[model samples]
Target chain A: GPKVLQIPSHQIIDMGQMVTLNCDPVSNHLYFYWYKQILGQQMEFLVNFYNGKVMEKSKLFKDQFSVERPDGSYFTLKIQPTALEDSAVYFCASTGGSSYEQYFGPGTRLTVL
Target chain B: QQQVRQSPQSLTVWEGETAILNCSYEDSTFDYFPWYHQFPGESPALLIAIRPVSNKKEDGRFTIFFNKREKKFSLHIADSQPGDSATYFCAARTEGADRLTFGKGTQLIIQP
Candidate 1:
């Protein structure tokens, strides 16, 4: 089974601060994605990245959010000037092809105060 | 606007019973449906999936019943056990789409 690992299982940050969540996806995965889940809510898609570019994004993905997997290293989601509403669990996922099941990481819980 | 909708936010069933969870979607282009299960302190995993070309998909005790005309689907867990208690999420993927639309999870509790 393919596994996606996320660093910093939990993080507490102040509002407006910059936070970067890291994800280590399956070695051979080509497509990467980010999703946000608020407490007791559905998981919402944030963005999808492929080939060093963003393929698509949802309304929840504000301008402050960005994703990158530089030099075939860890895929990272950077949120700058975070708001209070940014408190939620962030999940990272990866898939090998265009239409397939995605393997999710053990989400990183971000708390903004 | 919710693209995916799930009924019975929570359900409780006795052990050895059948647990039926329902889901519906508004997008007609969605052809791939995957049911995911997650437990406390665990990552969400794919339990089963079905494409529009099929009417049903079963894997062990987990089964998915899909209705393309109604734009709905459901997951049926038979012979439920206490270990089956967890949060189940129904997700939809449109053809050639990169993201999945997930419904609010259904929390299932199997009482022994």
Candidate 2:
């Protein structure tokens, strides 16, 4: 099975600090996505990116959040000036465009203090 | 509002018994339904899935029963084992859409 890898299993930062979560999606995958899961809650879609642009985003994707996969490198989600409510486990997923199934990576737990 | 909904916040089933988890969606455009299971401290993994074109899909002991007209689907784990205990999430995506809408997960406990 193809695997997606996420950097930093866990992260802790001050409320106003910036954090970047990196994802190494399956090499042949073209569509990428980011999801947020708070403890004891369901996972929520944050945004989806394809061809260097955002295709769709949920209301949970705040203005402070951004995503990019520059130069075919790692896809990243950057949060500037994080807030307390941003504390959650972030999971990265990707699809090869041939099927609707999206493979997920081990999540990166983000904690904002 | 949640586009997808799952019932039974938590369930306890005895080993060797059958465990059924239910799900429903509000969006009629959603054509793909996938059920993913997550062990504690682990990411969700696709277990079984079904499209509206089919009323049923099965793989090993896991089966997905889809009711397109009713806008509902369910995952059935037959001959359950202790290892089957995990949080199951039901998700849906419309054709040509890459983002998935997930239902609130149902935590299943298979008692031995």
Candidate 3:
């Protein structure tokens, strides 16, 4: 089975600080996605990336959020001026263009204090 | 409004029993339905999925029965075991869309 890896499984940050969550998607996969899941709540889609650019985003994707793959490297999500509501598990997913299945990482638990 | 809805926030089942999880959606355009299972401290993985073109899909003990007209679907786990205890999330995606709209999730506990 293929696996997607996330760096710093857990992160604790002070409010108003900048945090970058890194995801190493499956090597051969092209589509990348980011989702936010608050405790006891449904997982919400934030954004999806392809061809080195954002293809779609949800209302949950605030102006403070941005994503980039940077020359086929780790797909990164950067959030600035982190708010308390940003505290949640951030999951990264990837898919091969042809399949309906998307592989998800273990997720980075971001705690904004 | 929630686009995807799942019933029974939590469920408990005895070993060897059948566990039924229900899901419904508000979007008629949503044609792809996927069920994902997540264990504590892990990311969700796809358990099974179905398209509108098919009314049912089966994989081992896991089965999906979809009703496009009713805009509902369900996952039936036969011969449920302790290992089947986990949170199940039903999600729907529009055709050719890369994102999934997930239900609130249902936690299943299998008693021995």
- DockQ, in order, for the candidates? 0.87, 0.76, 0.86
Query: Between which residue pairs do clashes occur in model 2?
Result: none
lDDT of 1 by residue, B9-108 (tens): 9999999999999999988888789999999978899999999999999999999999988988999999999999999999999787789999999999
How far in Å is the alpha carbon of A77 misplaced in model 3? 0.4
Q: Kindly report which residue pairs in candidate 3 clash with one another.
A: none
lDDT of each candidate versus the true structure: 0.94, 0.93, 0.95
lDDT of 3 at B45: 95
Lowest summed lDDT across 10 adjacent residues in model 1 chain A is found at A97-106
Selected candidate, larger TM-score, 1 vs 3: 3
Runs of candidate 3 with Cα error greater than 4 angstroms are none
What 10-residue stretch in candidate 2 chain B is worst by lDDT? B93-102
The DockQ of predicted model 3 stands at 0.86
TM-scores, each model vs. reference: 0.98, 0.96, 0.98
Give the winner by TM-score: 2 or 3.
3
Report the lDDT of model 1 for residue B21. 98
- True-vs-predicted CA distance for residue A63, candidate 1, Å: 0.9
The DockQ-derived docking category for candidate 1 is high
